[model samples]
Target: MERLTDFVLRHKLAVVLAWVAVALAGTFAAAAVQDRLGARFGAPGQPAYEANQEIMRTYGGGLVPLVAVATEPVDFARLAPLGRVVTDPAFASDDGGTTYALLYPPQDGDLTEEITQILGPHVRVTGLEALEPEGGGGISLVAEILIGGVGALVVLAFVFGSPLAVVPLVIAAAAVLAAFLAVYGLTYLTDVSGVVQYIVALMGLGIAIDYSLLLVTRWREEGHDVRRAMATAGRAVALSAATVAIGLVATMVLPVPFLRAVGLGGVVIPLVSMAAVLTLLPILLATVGPRIDRGRPKPSRWAGWARRVIRFRWPALLVSTGLLVALSSAALGLNLGEPTSDSLARSGPAYETLAGMREAGLPTGALSPIPVLAPESALPVLRAVPGVETAVVAAPGLIEVIPDYEGTATVENVLASAPPGARVGGAVAQSIGFTASVYGAFPPMLVLVSLATYLMLAFAFRSLVLPLKAVLLNLLSLAAVIGALVLVWQEGHGSEPVWGIQALGAIDEFVPAMIFAFLYGLSMDYEVFILARMREEYDRTGSTDQAIVRGLGSTGRLVTSAALVLFLAFASLAAAPILQVKLFATALGLGILLDATLVRALLLPALVSVMGRWNWWLPSRLSRRATRRAPAPQAGPTSPAG
Candidate 1:
């Protein structure tokens, strides 16, 4: 590490130029990514896929008409130019004005505008096509980053009280852009979800800044000695990145292509950030760290807070534990359902057109009507279903069923009740299959993540008890975050006023697994940062109390500051146009903030103080060698940042 830092300092200018080239290439790659990206949530081998393949085989491969409405008619001849294919005359409304039209979304051109121009004001258009572009725009995503960057700068300046604080933000941006470049290349190899773009951009921003914060803070603490700081904090950050990546990489094993792509995208953020932080960070610190270190701000109050916590450790532990437990209890009420089609893209033709139709006294589910293809022999049984509104014959053997306003019949039930050769499909069936694909594969994926993370942390901390404690605490943090997610998104507490996120009633089914993997791994990262230092101090002096005090007092502010940077980055996601982005942004941001403060700063130090030597205890089979892997920091001069 010392040799690496020396090389960086020696050729700092060359290092900067290389990164400049990297940043330029990364920018171009990010720009081209969106063209290759898509929003397919369908998992291969699902029932929905089979149904679609059959449909394509029966009719030439294309989207069928998705919506139909009854009202005064327009000139079908005039709509012809806009790609509105006039339907059979017998299928018209009771007053002879209703006609169906085809609107294929996710296409190359602007289908939303064309649909509006062709249908005009009187005719109603709804269904999946109503939602034009899913998720957020480049402009809104940029706004999120800019706003988060500002918030992170404020926290960094206050925490370090130096212009060098901006160094983390700079490194973070480069890491994020670099990850975007990697993901862009990834899109060509595999069909990457558009969600991966937001995750890499937003979450990567926070994570990269976090690793940078630790390294920079350590440099300041080492009296601006870049080499020694790199040798110490550098190792910690690398291990930290690897440990977090373990959980992320586990997602690749999931059968669902959507989540597997997300997992693959997630691992890139930490790796890129780790590379940039270790290489470019040292270059910046070696060249500019001393200059910015001059005129540090007045003494931070964190030390005083640390002392108070140590003195009143018992009370702090009881209070924080009680609060965390209470919050986590809300997990029991979580409703595990996926986001509705309405929530996919809230500000588009798909959403607004439905709102207009609903206001005009149309059936609530009219936009998302269902089609049940059954043999003519079972037409009576299909129409007998309570939710069925209209049953029409499309061909000699095919029948289409439009559901009513309060359709409660699901695809599973509809399939079971259908005639032997019948099939039910459309938006409703697709949603059900998507949800099943996500949830059905969840358990095995979770087991893989949990078991792997546990082993990694056990190897890292070198204590069975300590690793177990870390896992349990991380689970608690995840549960609390899930509760918070439900409260904010499902219950609508602080959702509408802050970001216009409505009461969703139920969350995206994939949210819980995501929350668990991300929060557990990140919280463990902070755990390693704190406990590694504590273990180092204890090894040197064999005094648990002294080690706990010095360790927390030293790393507490930096860890919390790093957490704050990530929280701000995630908070920006709440403003995203996509419902999934909003949920992810809000949940992750809140979770990080909560874990860093209440869990890490207050609860952790207090618990270590109470546990004393037991915190470092390991079974005989693990060996004393496992108990101590890294050496204690050499006794030397300390700077103001500590």
Candidate 2:
């Protein structure tokens, strides 16, 4: 370990340059082949999502789903224009407007059935509510300025004492913004959804800024000379960035085009931002020289408290245990149900239009149900099921049924209110066999996938207790964010008075889960990385108390800096025009803040101290792997005092 650290320190410049070069090459290749990189999400034979184009051309229209309006007492004039829209040369229809035919071939049989059921009842509809026009309007302008500009300003101020912190964040933000524009450009060349492009850009920016912040913060703390510090910090952060890339890269396993794009962007942009940090940030630190540290305020009272907590054993234990109790309760309140389409609209103008239409007498009941597409011959059998609401045969193999709504609203609701088991799209897809219903079962399937992820972490850490603790901590953060989202976007409790947007219903179905998946992985990355360092220190020294303090204090600047970079990266997502992306960005960025401050800084240290001997405890069966013992609890600082 000493040799590794010494080698990293000795050739910091070479190491940093090597990282920068590789990252640059990757970014360039990714951008150049952005079309191909994106193409990886499409059909089995073809590259990209070009299949969506053929679906669009054959079915006639674009890739986005259209929402149809159905009412017995409909406003003829208001809906008159929609009749033409339904039959327009640009549009396609099936089931006598019972189904809003895809502009492309149906992605999945279940999705097609679900769409048919949802539209079956509607008499009027439009292109799956098109996003506000390009270039954005006044509301978008305000959102951008406030959410991106002001939000970034406030966070930078809180995290870094000097204005210099903003520099790397700005660079990261620019790199991310450029990446988005590049994605937008790729859409012209390849068949990419606008929303997917929007998400990719935001994700790229947020992560880049975040990782850069970690590097710069460490550089400032360690280097006697700014250049050397920059080099050292850059090397460490670059490695950290690589780990993050690995975690995000794992997301490619998902079949959805948008998720794949997000995962790729998450990997690509961080590497890009890392290059900028290694090259630009270090140069800037050197050129700005000593001025970079100028006008820094006295450390806050909390900072002092932080130092003391890190040093003491019982206090640390108390803090961690306390957090565990409080956050655990919060996690208990989590509402993990999928967000309805109405909820998704809360972010933009389309929401109000939908509400007006609903008031004008649309079926504004529960969320759209799952649509079951089975052999038309099975219609009676489905209707015989106790919960099935309405079932009808539309095509040769199609039988649509709306189930009696339940609180959980599982995929059984297909064709009426949203499908049951839709929460697990993959499992549903697998269960149904073929490539059918992948999207329908996504909502339910993800819960299992997330659980599987937790298990993997446990297996890796080799501790039933520690993995549970990590998951519980992450859940706490997730719940807090969800509560905040519900209040801000749903009930509209204080949105207008606070953030200046009217509250919408639920967020998108995919938004919350994707955010959870992305952040859960990212948060775990930090936990693993930091714990690895702490464990290494404990292995060397027999003092648990000394190890806790030194481990935290030594990595203090690293964690703090990394948090800032990550925060910036996430905030960049909030800058996008899409409300769904903004929600995801806000939730994820906020999650990082909570994790870094409350979870890592206060909670983790406290719990470690409290656990004492038990922190590294393992079963006798695993005793062979536990060759070394952790330090026993002690009362004082162990660092050699200057």
Candidate 3:
């Protein structure tokens, strides 16, 4: 750490110029990166995905057909030129004024407008794709980043109270731009999700700001001694970034292509943020840090709060544990699946069309017709399945089954009843396959992440108990966050009032995993920050009580400030029109706030206080092997507070 800091300080000018060039190149690449971004949510090798592949090979489109509803009878002959158009007598409402047709256009093109034009003004189109929230393009992306950046600036000003506040933002911008360059290069190798862009910009902003904030705060605390700050806080920043990377990289273990791509792309955010913090930030601090850091430091009340908590450790522990447990109970009701069409969009042309369909007593399931590749003889069998509204042969050896509802049960029943060698593929089937494939492998992934994180924290802290405590607390924090998500989104307790989005009935399938991947690492960042300080004080003073007080006193504000920055970034993300992005953002924002306050501020300190010397325990054999140094000191007489 000293050598790196020395090198950065020695070549400050060269480092600044190099980063300026990279940032400029990245600024130019950012616009081009958006064009290369795309979304794919298929589970390769899964039954439904393989079947959809075959179906798409035979017919241009196979996943879900676009539904066109009109006041007049739809002309199937005119639509034939667009793609395969299938209709049944049952597709008409009982009132006979409304009729709909399913159009399977080539997957490469959209036929919604063409079909709407062909059917005239009374025509309304609603489908799985059509129901997605609109206008979440590059404009919204820039708006969100700006809003988040403004919020972060406010928080930074409060923290630093000087022109120095802008330094973190500068570091964040450079890191985010650099990550854009990496992602742009990544696009040529594989298709990256458009979602990655939002995450890279917003999350990268928060993380880079956080790393820079920690280092700068430490440097100031050390009387502008850059070497001391780099050796102490710099190590914490590196560990925090590594943990974040571990959490994101764990997502690559899932079989889903889009998720693996997301994991691959997300890993870049932290790496670049760390790079900027370690290299670019130090240079800025050495060169311009003294000039800008002219504000008087304010006195903090966190020491008194920490002392009080340690004084009343028992009450603090019980109250914090109770609150977290109460919140975590909501996760028991979490349902993972795609949102219903009604929850996809609230006020759009497609939304109005779906409402009209429902009002006319048209089955909503027609919006997600199941396509099966099988002989014509299997059509009668598929029709006989319960919950199936009707079945018709849409093409040679292809049967389309319209169910009463789009659900896993319907897809399962179709798969079960289909003849040997038959393949069933549709939106519901694909969703089910995705849930099964992603979650079926989740347990092992969780184990891998936990084990890896535990070892890393243990080595960094050189304490077995502290690392274990950190891991368990992180998990508990994540569970409470998920519970909050269920309450806000799935149960609609606050979603409607807060975001104006109705209850989704079920959380998006990928959301929970994404939340875990992100929040686990981010929440741990606080753990690393607070506990690293605690461990440092413990080593210096050999008094757990003093360690708790001094550590919390020193880092409590920093943790809160960092959490607020991240929360604001995610809050900006919540403003996006996309429902899935909204859910992801809201959950992460809530998680950061909750973990920073309840878990880190209350439970973590109280628990460490109650545990006393046990919190620092490290077995001699393991400590020697892990740290290649002397084992931790044996527990002495307890402090009067302990």
Candidate 4:
């Protein structure tokens, strides 16, 4: 750490110029990144994905087809100009007042506007792609970053109470651009998801600022001694970044391509951010850190709060634990699937058209018709399936089944009755396939991440119980975040009023897994920050209660400030028009805030105080095996201060 700091100080001008060049290159790369990104959600090797590929190969289109509805029957053949138009007697509503046809356009063609032009004004055209909220008024990526930047500036000012606030922002900007460059390179290697762009920008901003903030704050606390700060706080920043990377690693190892891309793209956020903090940031601090940090330091009130918690540990523990338990209970009701059509677009031509269909008593399931590839002789058997509303032999060896609704249950019923060689493929079936393929592997992934994180934290903190407690608390915090998501977005407890989105009926399929992977590590960041300091204090004072008070007092405000920065970055993503993006941002924002407050601030301190001396118990046998040498023992007072 000292050598790195020395090198940065020695070549301060070169470091600044190099970062400036990287940032400039990254700006251009960010503009081109969008074109390279994909939105594909197919899980390779899954039956539905394979089947969809086969159907698309045999027929013109296989994935969810665009539905065109009209009040009067016209020459349906006119729509053939767009693509293969599938029509059937069952496509018409029972009332005969409404009719619909499915258009399977070219795989890569976006024909919604062209279809609307050809079909004329009277025809209402809608599809999976068309159902997305226009988000015309929502803030763009630049605007979101600017807004988040402004919010972070405010928090930074409050934390440092000076021009030092701008330093972290600068580090954050360079880190974001660096991460963008990494993601751009990733695009050439793999099909990166469009979602990675938003994550890399916003999350990169938060993480970079967080690392810089920790380093700068510690530098100030260390009386502006660059080497001392780098040795102490710099180590914590590295550990914090590692924890964040550990969480993202879980996602990268998943079999899903897009998810793997997302995880791969996300991992660079912390790595680049850490690089900037450890390399570029030291130069900035050594040169101008003292000048910008001219504001008089103000004592944090969190120390008093910590002292009070120590004074009344039992009450603090009960209150915080009870709140987390209540919030976590809401997670039990979390449903994973694609959002319903009603939740897709609240106000648009597509929405009104779907509304008119509903008003005409037309089955909305026609919007997401299931395509099954089998012998034409299997049509009658599929149609007789309990949940299938209608089935038709659309081609020589292809049959399309319209279910009563779009859900896994309907897909399962069709699959059960399907002939031996049949392959069922559609949006719902794809979702089910994704759930089975991705989440089926989630348990082992979770175990792997947990065990790996436990080992890492155990080694870093040199304590058996502390690492265990941190892991368990992080899980509880994550559950609470999901529960809050369930209430806000899934159940519409506050979603409609706050974001103007209706109850989504279920969370997006990939959301929970993404949230778990990201949040587990992110929330653990605070665990490392606070616990590392507490361990230091315990070693110094040999009193558990004093360690708790001193540790929380020193790091509480910093953790809160850092978490607020991350939350703002995440909150900026809520302005996105995509429902999945909004849900992802909300979950992460809520998780950071909840973990920083309930889990880190109140529950963590209380629990540590309650555990007393056990918090630092690293058995000599375990310590020797982990570190190749047992750690020196330190005696501490057993009880919490009254």
Regions of model 1 farther than 4 Å from truth: 1-18, 53-68, 71-138, 297-300, 303-315, 336-365, 394-398, 405-409, 627-642
Clashes of 4: 0
Kindly give the number of clashing pairs for every candidate.
3, 58, 0, 0
Score each candidate by Cα lDDT: 0.70, 0.49, 0.87, 0.85
Error of 2 at 483 (Å): 6.5
Per-residue lDDT of 275 in model 2 = 59
Residue by residue across 1-642, what tens digits does model 1's lDDT show? 677777877888888898888889899988889888888765567665566555545643233344534356655445445442324454444445445443323233444445556667666565644443333332476788888889999998887777887888889889988998899889879988887878888788888888888888778778888888888788788878987887776567766777778888888988999989989999888777788776464454655666677788899999999999888888778876534445445665456655655555444444444455566777788767666655666555555555555223644556668777676665557656766777677678767767776777667666655676777778788889888988887777867667655566677666776766566667777887888777767766767666776677678877888888888887777667776777887888888988999998888877777765666666554645654445322222231112
Tens-digit lDDT track of model 4 for 483-559 = 99999988888878887766777887899989987888889988898998888888778788888888998888889
Error of 4 at 316 (Å): 1.8
- lDDT comparing candidate 2 with the true structure: 0.49
- Model 2, 147-230: lDDT tens digits are 554555566656666777567555665565455545544555545544454445445545565666555555556652654554
Pairs of residues at least 3 apart in sequence or in different chains that clash in candidate 3: none
Model 1 lDDT vs. the true structure? 0.70
Q: Kindly report which residue stretches of model 4 are placed more than 4 angstroms away from their true locations once superposed.
A: 93-97, 105-132, 342-362, 621-642
Candidate 2, residue 350: lDDT: 40
The 10-residue segment with the lowest total lDDT in model 4: 633-642
Q: lDDT winner between 1 and 4, please give it.
A: 4
- In model 3, the worst 10-residue window by lDDT is 633-642
